[model samples]
Target: MIEEPPTTTQRSAEVERRRAGELARPLTRPAGPIAVYDTVTDGMTGWQFLRTGRWLAYTAAAILFAIICLFLANWQFDRGQQASADNAVVAANFSAEPVPIELALPTLGSYDASQNWQRVSVTGVYLANEELVVRNRSNSGTNGFEVVTPLQLSDGSVFLVDRGWVQPSPTDALNPDSIPRPTSGTVSVVVQLRPSEAPLGTGSTTGNQIQSITLPRIQQTTGGDLYTGAYGLLNSQAPAAEAGLTNTQTSMPVEDVGTHISYMVQWLFFALLGFFALGLAARKVHRELNSDDPEERERASARMRKRARKPFTDEELEDEEIDGFLPLTRWGLSSGTGTGSVAGKTVGPTAAPRVVSPAAPRMALKQDDDAGDREQGD
Candidate 1:
């Protein structure tokens, strides 16, 4: 029988076509995050992922991510609600012909949250010489500075006016002189939205020395109260074109209502995920933790502890005997003189009772014979 040639994966048309398609396609959101390998599914796709402990981790992480995603969606929704409310008030305040500048200022103390977008007008002395430009700001893929001209109101209150972004140099972002220098003079000013800033946390960077304009690093350096939120994000009408600097306005951010509700959902999801992941890890080791059959483990542990505390014994050493003095040979005694007695008398010192290993049985036999001889004599 003849067999066809085995081909490399790249050589196969189907594989090549699939790879090419994947390479050609732009990444977009799919129906679900877990559906990426749908073609590989033969009813065991889930089980395969479940086999690795990583799957449990992924599951936990996914729950956390899901909570985040949901929360963001909800938070985004809340923002939309806020924005809508603001828009309505802004519409009401804005429609009335521009009020003279001073009326807007004294009304701030009495303002309500519903009137967040209340229009403010001021007859101000412009500190145009103090043109503070926030540097390294990029808008619409073009690098520029957000020019903030500090408006000194007739009442002596200082407010920052975010004029707009301007390209200081055609290619470079660093042309302070190229920026249209504001001519310092008193002028009627109008602002619909006044925003506030948050503290920059332990930020480190070389920042533009401009006084009013705020960025994260700049906020840390100059610790000042900036805007509550970004304004003129509507880009609906241009005060600049009305004032004549000639540049395209920045595009407004999407007015999405789903963000806050989404964020809350996301946080809730995270909490749930934390629970689920801990559960899986708990499950993996549960039987061992709660086992009733623990004799072997306990015994091993006990033995180890006993061995650690054991004391030394003395059986490994030998007993030593020290000779009191020189033997007959060493004392230079003649052989005949040293036979069981010294100087034809008992030794100078009394001897200890001998433990007669060699002649013990013979000594006993002699004692028995002496007893028999006494009996016979009797």
Candidate 2:
């Protein structure tokens, strides 16, 4: 008894099974400096990705990171602009005519650049015991301290006054000789109105030395109805000792525009990088799903896998050969054959047999006759 060749249907089914098996095999890529194309192409394609919740999560995360970076960049830019404006205000009002303290002070939150470093006059009794020493203050490149004493105004409200810089004694103690003593009675004082300092959560709490002079913190610590702004004493009406004490040093806002600009550029770069990478991945998936040629898709996938391998080290380059790292070839795949069959019809490279036209045979015969005639003529 003889057995018949497998029918076309059976062959098709077998091919489908082989193709499915090949696809089901896991692809493993090593960790290293993988190419962007490899990173994009090595994942699930098209609808497979769209149908999964993981892909949505990944896309959302990328977008969120880009937005956060952009927000930080904008914040830095705004801060730079604010600094420039503050510097301008300091320059314009540093030596201007004195204004009344009430005219500069706002009824609400805090005084801004409009009042910062502006000279003002006020009559008050200095609260000697409630003074705070600003630690680690430097003047003329020498480490010293600034005494912040509160002045009790006639209206019963208190104003924190940054008196002056003072040098410590030889024993590192608060030197009475360093600080100038305020007059015994209520007196008129000329002071430069300044913005409240930033609150400090850290630094020395020992003795009278405090890290910062924020008005709110002072109000809380010293139990006083304090003014929103601080005053840097310029001069006292009452006769004062000519000590080495200097008025509060007005600080210049840092005008480092280049640093903030660089940071903005960096954040923008990160946003662009994330967006383009995501687009590349989406494009790769679209191509893989829409392509009609299965063999081409497989080859592309294999190329991506090869590119995803770990980068070669100097030692590995010297000791190991990379020639043996080839992927499984097209020759062994179901779609590898020269003749591709569909619904019992053969197609592709070997689809049709080559047949010479009758006109070609007649032309060849005429050529032979012409050769014979030429031979006779010769």
- The parts of candidate 1 lying over 4 Å away from their true place are 1-96, 99-102, 107-117, 175-177, 199-254, 258-378
Task: List clash counts for every candidate, in order.
Answer: 36, 0
lDDT per residue for candidate 1 within 1-378, as digits (tens), equals: 544543444234432222122212222321111222233322332135355566566676767676666666666666778867666765575444544434444332233454444555555555666556655666678656666665565555455666666666666545543555554455565555444434433434333435333334333443444222322211222232234233334322234445555665666666666767666864443323322235533443344334423332232111101221122211112112111222223222222111111113244334434765799789
lDDT tens readout by residue for model 2, 347-378: 33321111112223333333434765799789
Per-candidate local distance difference test: 0.43, 0.59
RMSD (Cα, Å) of model 1 = 33.3
Q: How accurate is candidate 1 locally (lDDT)?
A: 0.43
lDDT of 2 at 180: 63
**Candidate 2 residue 261 C-alpha distance from true site, Å:** 3.5
Q: Pick the candidate with the highest lDDT.
A: 2
- In model 2, which regions exceed 4 Å deviation? 1-58, 106-113, 123-132, 136-143, 150-159, 173-177, 183-189, 197-228, 233-241, 255-258, 279-378
